[model samples]
Target: MMAPATTSRPTSATAPSTFTSSCTRRTDGVTMCAWRDSGTRIVPTSSTSTRCRNPATPTRRTSRSVNSATRRSSRRGSPPRSIPCVRCRIRNRRKSPPGRSARTRSRCRRVLSARRCACGIDRIRSWLTRTRCCFMRRCWRSCSLVLIAFVLAACPTKTEGGGGDGSFEVQDPLTRRLMDPDATTDERIDRVLAEAKPGNTAALPALLRVMRHRSQAAFLVVSDGKARFGYRTVELRETQKDTRSMERVAAIVALEAINSPVALPDLVLALDDVNEVVQNHAARALVRLGNRAGIPTLIANLDNRILQRETANRLLEEISGKQGFIADAGWAERQKGLAAWQEWWAGIQASDERLPIEGRAYQIGADAEADRRIGFFVDVVGQYQFLFHEQARKALIRIGEPALPFLREGVERARKDDNATTRAGIAQILETIDHPNGRELLRDLLTDASGSVRARAAEAFGNLAGKGAIAALQGVLGDRDPGVPIAALDGLGRIGGADALAVIRRYVPGEDSALQEAHILATFAASRGREQRDRTLAMLLGVSIATRNAAHAVLVRITGDDAGYDSLATESARKEAMERYRGLLGG
Candidate 1:
């Protein structure tokens, strides 16, 4: 019945005991593990893979062949199963010793990727069907269930975090720790930095996962702020989320340090992040990557006071080879430079050109991105909404040189169709832009049949005033339109010096007339040189407070010195300030 007793290799007394438990072989000849009778543990099914102590030969997955094989094996009566020392191996594997997870994970990966599963469920099932052992057939159902329980209870599911994509499973321990949810922020960040090596682009998704999840409670601000004086002091009590999580920050830095070209888009999108640190880091990384696509955010950063504007400005200069970096320029002054950069970048995009990213030339051709931007803003230039109009006006100005032709065309159409409002709006923008190329354009606009356009053009010349515009301003003084002559006088006042001042004196109304203040302001604007200012200042020395205020305003505009005049101060106080100004003038 026992098929003749057999003896195998003798065991050492010093080693742990094994033969104390036994597995019986059925008359039909399939062997069972002793652990089943003794109830010992084996490797639990988790991310790690393991094996049965007495695994049977494996079978193919196709059910039909397995059934045919089973039928033939039953009739042939062949003995094909073996029983080795299963009890001791099962006892040893029941609980893994410490420091074994990484090795087990590695081994499991190899087994899952290159060989049959460790539990051999299919092999045992196939062995059960082929053998004529009645006792083994019953064991097959329970064994399959128990093996499945081991796997499901302890093994990683197909969609577990780090190795969800079997193809992208993380092998490096530090990388795996970086993605661990329960790890402290510092611990995670350290692990992320540890993997900052070349060819680690495989970990980019993990790095970016930390970047995009953005939920680290980066700081514990015990107090939001305590107001000690007029200002609230939050110096030591602010969250990094109020700034940006260092873990995420470290991840981004690691991405750049890793120097993978594929990180370009992540850097670009980070340019729009709410946190300034993220944007700054992203911008710097993108510049190093040699990608022109980062141009938009850099331009946007050009005006952000919190950003390194000078650095951004310098980068723009080097990247685009254009110069308009006015460090002290106000928003109004910056529009032209920013617009120029936009136009150049947009033109490149529209032309089906590649702005390299990640060491590859990725080209995008968006005809309408350039065209539609200029077109929409050009159409909105003279619209009714004040805010929208201002935005359109700025956008058009920022579109820079490319937008000029369209703006010129719009002005011409307005003039031809006698649309005074539209015509005047275009003239106003040209005045604000003061582009030298538009001076000729302004000269044509000053003669538009629309009186309102002529007035706006003359006013534009006042701001655009230089010696060359003197003749143009003087000619408009004789126009039949009353508003045009006043506007021309305003333009000449800012230019023509003594000669223009003499011309202006004729238009000054009688002291009692309503136009006196208008002429008075023009006289103030015309005084450029000391001689002219002396004559003008002498005239206004004893006039209305309003008149002195007008002269006071003009002096500050033409000359950077404030001249100590305070419009809000009493008249005698103003006189004292005026005396100081006249002394500075050496009048």
Candidate 2:
């Protein structure tokens, strides 16, 4: 019959009879035969990849049939085995014409670039070539599967905000530093705070991690160092400043700086942080955010230790605008109040109504309308975003003396609150109120028992009372709190008189802490036309960089020139700059 069509198929001796080189309109989606392996070609295949290729010219015995051996072997009931799948079309890849699918193009990249995939494919080929067809039909399949399992297991998984408990990337370097044990990094924290804009929630995950973390670095500590997990007396460094208990406090500060509603849930939940200091910070953040969700937690803390009870009542007063809760009352005294606080919180919750609260740091008063305006502005001033705090301060000043009674009341109430930032914010409103009503109250606040309150009030008095408040500020010069004296100096310097300068000159450098001395020296620059401006110049030569920092910053702001004065520079360099500035100054 036409010489039996002169069959062109190769005999078994010439090539493996089971090779599948099918080229019959392959829908494997690959088109070009770019890469080739001689003898037995093995290519790795995965769900996302195909490492095998078909020959360009249809080399199934040159054309009598494609994949002739595979079909033949299958019909003979040879249990199917994975050979180099020649019909698995090789991607045209670089040769692929325009309009090739994105999927095909991407697959082309993965096959060529992924070294592991290429190696795995090469290995599969090696295994197939080493084994006879009979052996490949059985154990080779198992071996290939094990190898693939190993390759896939080595790859890391990609994720996006998955459950929010895993690692994530943030643009700020402070993410790790803020969350880690050595979180005393204020320069990094200030950088992050400067960017804690309304829309920038990138650092929110890291901030939350810090709030939720209660684990402090456990190492040896000196006897007097503050310890959260109780103290164990061990001989450590003699000059250790403070302990690691301040770690979470840094995070709470950053979160408040973020001033975003997105952090509300995390801030509320952080109220239960094992460290009461952290708890107090979280409570203040929630109040400034204007959400009463954490009120129950603070109220629950009322039944806790006296410290927690005092903190709870303090935060509760801010939220509810009521101040009847006595902070130092024993548990027996506060137990009844605890039940009342819980009931009050529950009732507000059930009604789905906003609590009649003043703010995180201020309070409402008998005058509801004025209380509303003051609270509204008070909340705005605490939000640092978009210069909203500055704008709100201007608004409160415009409200004038009529708002003073409530504003003064808010500042007094702010004393018991632990959020110094919020306390300072409320104090700033009083400082610039321009209303004469709060002047005496501002003077009175300078002598309050709380150091922070006294410090805040002292700074406020300079703006509210000016030269008139000098006697009050002088009384505060010998105050026990290191910051109080500095605050008093700042106030007196703002007033700038012979009397104020005389008080400023009384600073005996060794008598106060370095920071206090630094601050006092900085105040001298604020007191212009005084001969003591040279005192600020002298402070620039101090050993403590913090002391120099305060002095340098004030000089720069006042003179509008640094004179190459770098507070962070070497001691000799600082002295040089100080000399240069002295040359710039008269005497």
Candidate 3:
């Protein structure tokens, strides 16, 4: 048929005879050829044969088919192989034109498949090697975006209230609320006072800040038609009087509540406040804190015209064991009392022996000799270190009656040397002893030149609670020093006799509030039975509100009847209430 279709094969001697070429006639009337190796399998190959001119006629092997053939060839022990078709490989390198038909696309896929089989492992290896850098670049870009988002979330945003130099800001919420204009005066005062409870130390700094704060308004008119001064901005007016009072009161209450020696400095500063109540509270808080540093201020305030004068005098007497120099003296006579106090202060300062031992001059130990301990007690008492005074008193007390003789000798020696501190310490010890001789010794000190010495002596007499020194105590009732009279009244209360009652009654009608308070206390002690209470109730009529209030409190304690008295009520209301009580007592 057609002259037996002459065939052509590879002429090389290395080409095996088992390898064969197939030819297929296409509809276009052209022939195409494919080659198969006996050892490998069917593989596409470019041919120069004249009968194989139509490229489409030869069936191009797909990658799937090539892989199958490769697996079969490996099992048959064929060597590594590839399709020998250079033209097909060059065709795979060109991109297909746009808008190719489905059949054309199918043809392209087949060509690509055949090209993959021809290239085999070498094509895959080249692709991976070429794309390594680009793959890493794409992965890095994705990771960078995710990292940027995380960093933004972790950082804090800047705020207007943040510290300018990158320090942590201090914020007090209660203080901010207090400053709010919407807050009522009563609400603010109540909140500030609530912070004054014991153990609320965290509020201490804020309370101190509040104390130092000045209102931004100026020229406040108080409710009682008085002019009160303040600092205020031009925009602010009419600051509440109660608001300022509450702030000051809160500060004093906080100092007292904390009751710490560390608050002593602030309490001292508060003594200089313009408010008389603040100064009074500060002095009292200082005494409660057991800080003698406030003693000077209290002494200075004894001459103050404010209501705090009596309070300051009382605190000074309590702290220094000294009589207030001027109890009922006029302004001119008070100058002499102040001079006497200065003279005593100067005398103690000039005495080298009165100086307290500092550093290692004294050390207390359980193993120390009795003589050494006694010396330490003496030094501690003489020293101005009020903190150690209580401890020293305890040591002497522990020494018991055996130490009384030594203390008595010390008192005599101190008086000769004009050592007021030592004499005061001796007087305190003798008061604790309450011996018959101790009472007599205290009576002698009651007339000592130093007002402090006389005050301590009077205190000792009151503690003794015996009628032995009542005459000596009564003699000082007319003494110029305020503390002496007060102490005498207190001593007479403890002793309790007709003469003491008569002296206390004399002060009940007096105008001095301090003396009146002392008189009420003394009478309360001297009144022994129901008859005394009824008699004292009769005497309380028509007194000042302060005196009547004191008498009402005493009557309530003794008789368990408040007598319809209300301290906070108006003057007329209180008077009417007192009149009702008097009628009940048949006065």
Q: At residue 172, give the lDDT of candidate 1.
A: 45
Clashing pairs in 3: 216-232, 216-233, 217-232, 324-483, 327-482
Error of 3 at 433 (Å): 1.6
Model 1 agreement with the true structure over 1-587: per-residue lDDT tens digits: 22222122222334321212234433322333332211234312222112222222233322565545544533432211222233323333343344645334323332232234344767545544544444445566788899999989797553323423222233445446676756676777788788678767667756765564343211111111232111111111122343225666688778878876545434554565565556656665665555444567777776777345665676666554567558468777777777777787789768945443333322222233334334444555565656445545554443344456767777866666666777777777787665676788888988888788889998888878864577788778767677877677667767757777887876645443324555665776665544455544543464566655656666676666776666667667767776776776665
Please, what are the lDDT tens digits per residue for candidate 2 over residues 1-587?
01111112233454532223322222433322122123445322232323333222242223335356545643542312222233332333453345656344434443333323344667556645643344334566787799999998897543112212223322334455554333345653554455456555676656654454432211111112353212222211112233433545666777777675545434554554556666776776766666554565676677777777787787777667766477677766677787778788778768856655423322235334335445544544444443445544554554444446655656544555544444566666678665456777677666666688788888888666554688877787778888877777767766766776776677654554754564455356546624557677888888777777777777775667889877777878887898777766655
Each prediction's TM-score versus the true structure: 0.39, 0.36, 0.31
Instruction: Tell me how far candidate 1 lies from the true structure as C-alpha RMSD in angstroms.
Output: 28.0
Q: What lDDT tens digits, residue by residue, belong to model 3 across residues 163-215?
A: 12221222556655544446676776677777877767666656654553442
Query: Cα lDDT for residue 421, model 2?
Result: 49
Q: How accurate locally is residue 50 in candidate 1, as Cα lDDT from 0 to 100? A: 25
Task: Evaluate all candidate structures by whole-model CA lDDT and list the values in order.
Answer: 0.55, 0.54, 0.55
Quote the lDDT for 147 in model 1.
96
Q: What is the lDDT of candidate 3?
A: 0.55
With a 3 Å backbone cut-off (N, CA, C), the pairs that clash in candidate 1 are 41-94, 45-154, 45-155, 46-154, 46-155, 46-156, 261-358, 339-398, 493-526
Candidate 3's TM-score reads 0.31
